[model samples]
Target: MKKILVLGAGYVAQPLVNYLLKNTQFELVVADVHLEQAERVSGNRARTQAVSLDIRENEKLEQLIEQTDLAISLLPYTLHLQIAKACIKFRTPLITASYVTPEIRKLDTEAKEAGIVILKEMGLDPGIDHMSAMQVIDKIKADGGKISSFKSYCGGLAAPEANTNPWRYKFSWSPKGVLLAAQNGAKFFDKNQIVDVENDRMWEQTWPLQVDKFNLEAYPNRDSLPYISRYKLEGIETLVRCTLRFPGWVKTMAALREIGFFDSESQKSAEKLSRDKLLRQLLHIPNGTGLRQIFKERAGQFWTEEIEERFDWLGLFENTPENRHNENTSAIDFLVSLMIEKMSFAKNERDMVVLHHDFIYEKAGIRHNWLSSLIEYGRPDGTSAMARTVAYPAAIAARFILEGTINLSGVQIPVLPQIYNPVLQELTNQGIHFSDINKKI
Candidate 1:
């Protein structure tokens, strides 16, 4: 049997691991920094092995890549470049859920020459989002229609039944990733013009979105201008990709940003400060200041009852001894740590993944609108929706590569019909189908 080496057994790795073991004949080797975590995922399966791997050890990492027919990296995006180099050196196919950076893109010629595929962005937003959109876009083109506008939104959130928290969200994946994304400036196409939102104003600029009676908010995700060419939507007048969240999320995040909670700069004086002291310094309040007074002074008119309640629930204003701030923590890290403690999914709670795409096309002088939406929920205390939706596509792509269905050799994404169609069909068979609605406008 062919062998697949999975790097970094993280929160989202288990579903991919289980899918390969149950559905394929490939031998699976899961490697991570923590042996127990890797072993937990492996479960002593007949064709599976777990090993401790510190990716920094180049010799060991390269050796593992050399031994496997394919390498699937579940590591952080920053580490994917090194793994991609190893995969090239070993002449092994590679797949990852992370975005392809410029550095990784530079390896396309090398990977093409080696006749090995290095597929990137094979997970949730970049994965299903790209595949599902392309499926529609291609059909529209084939039907002699031209897409006039396209907008898409995706989110990982608490299921309706598990929506007890004020935030209406829980960490199904990395809390740090969610926090880091909040600080990104966004650019999207609207009315034949490029609209850019600065990082500080991202949260303040949101659109109200309604999905099947569930009211939510949408804010622009990362740069969407590049996708005009990436998806070949040259004549499209409007193109936007956004992230969905509950109604109050944007306001809460805006308040947090106003208070410098998302700042990444290091503060030397905060090294030995207590939680309360750190809060005082960060907010520019005196040490003896009351929490309410400090909030009033610092936030001015930006603070609302919802924001105040969220901060109070997170114990950000409390002098509790257990909330001891980390000595070396950056502002963003400190906020992420607090979010991890306050916003984690409970044992009995379920998470949800929502992906919705809107396509407006014109055919024979008539305008038509097509909407496709996917809503998947997780089993309580089992595989999360975020994990399943993110990992399953990668696993499906891996199987396809092994079966010689995907024979392309280069650094690529799932925008082509050959790549997206089969994966979308398989996703439907695996109970991750999107509901489509068509109408004339």
Candidate 2:
């Protein structure tokens, strides 16, 4: 029997593992640094086993790679290169949900030569977003329309009923990952000119966006210029990619940025301090001064009672020893810890994922506007919408590669028809499809 090796059994791994076990005949091994985490997902099922794996152990990783027909690295993006090297050495196919990096892209030639596919960006924003966008782009071009403008935005948040916090959001995935994304500089085309936004100014660039009846705000996501050629939108005007969040998030993030929550050097300086002291150090508040007044002065226009309440509720002002952990933890680390502890969903509460795309094209001298959107809600059974949207597409892609349905090799994403068409169809079958509308302008 063929074998499959899965690395990193985290929040999203269970859905992917369950999908594979139910749909395929492959023997499976779910490995993690924590054997219990791997075992929790593997469930002692037939042809499935759980094992401990510290990815740093190259020999064991290679041995497992050599034995499996394919390997899926659900490990953190930083660790994927090591796993990829092992897979390439053993001529084993590898898949990941993380975005493709330059180092990984450079391996295309080597991966192709090894006769194995190294698929990246197979998760939510990078995965479903690519597949869904390409489907529409391909169809519009096939119909002889020229795309003049395209914008896409995606977000994961607490479902309406579950949004009880002052921040109106909760962690469905990595809190640190979400915070790190805010530090990214972005570049995108607007009206035929490149608009560059530095990391510090990202939140300042947001504008309110209406997706169906849900009012939200959007700020540019990472670099979008490279995707013009990738999406065959060369010479296109007004192309942008954005990250969505509920209203008030942008202003709050801007305040956080101004207050030094995202500064590593400053965070290091504030290390070993209690939460309130850390906040004081970051804000330069004098001892015995009022936090509200000092914070409001520092936050300036971003200051609001609701934002203050959010920070207080997060325990940022707490002086208790309970708020301190790992004396060496930095301010950012403390904030992430607080978010993970205080912002996690309650029992029976669910999260939501939103993806929206808008397009403008011209065909036969007539202009048209196209809109495509997807809104997914998590199950009461504890399966998060983030997990489903992020893992399901990757699981499907893995099956296709193993079944020889996706014949091409080398570094790849899921933009091609052979990959996107069937995957989109299956997603719809799984009740996670989009709503699209086209009309003359």
TM-score of each: 0.96, 0.95
Query: Across residues 1-441, which tens digit of lDDT does each residue of candidate 1 receive?
Result: 989999988888899988898755799999999999999989898999999999999999999999999999999899999999999998999999998899999999999999999999999988999999999999989999999999999998889888887777889655888877777889999999999999867766699988876788999998999999999999899999999999878767767777777777665462456677776665556767586766755666578888788788887877654334454556777778788888888887888888999999999999999999999999755889999998999999999999999889999999998899999999999999999998999
Q: What 10-residue stretch in candidate 1 is worst by lDDT?
A: 320-329
Candidate 1 TM-score over all chains jointly:
0.96
How many pairs of residues in model 2 come into backbone collision? 0
- In model 2, how large is the Cα lDDT of residue 415? 83
Estimate, for each residue in 11-111, the C-alpha lDDT of model 2 and write its tens digit. 88999988888765778999999999999999999989999999889899898999899998889899999998889999999999999989899899999
User: Best TM-score goes to which candidate?
Assistant: 1
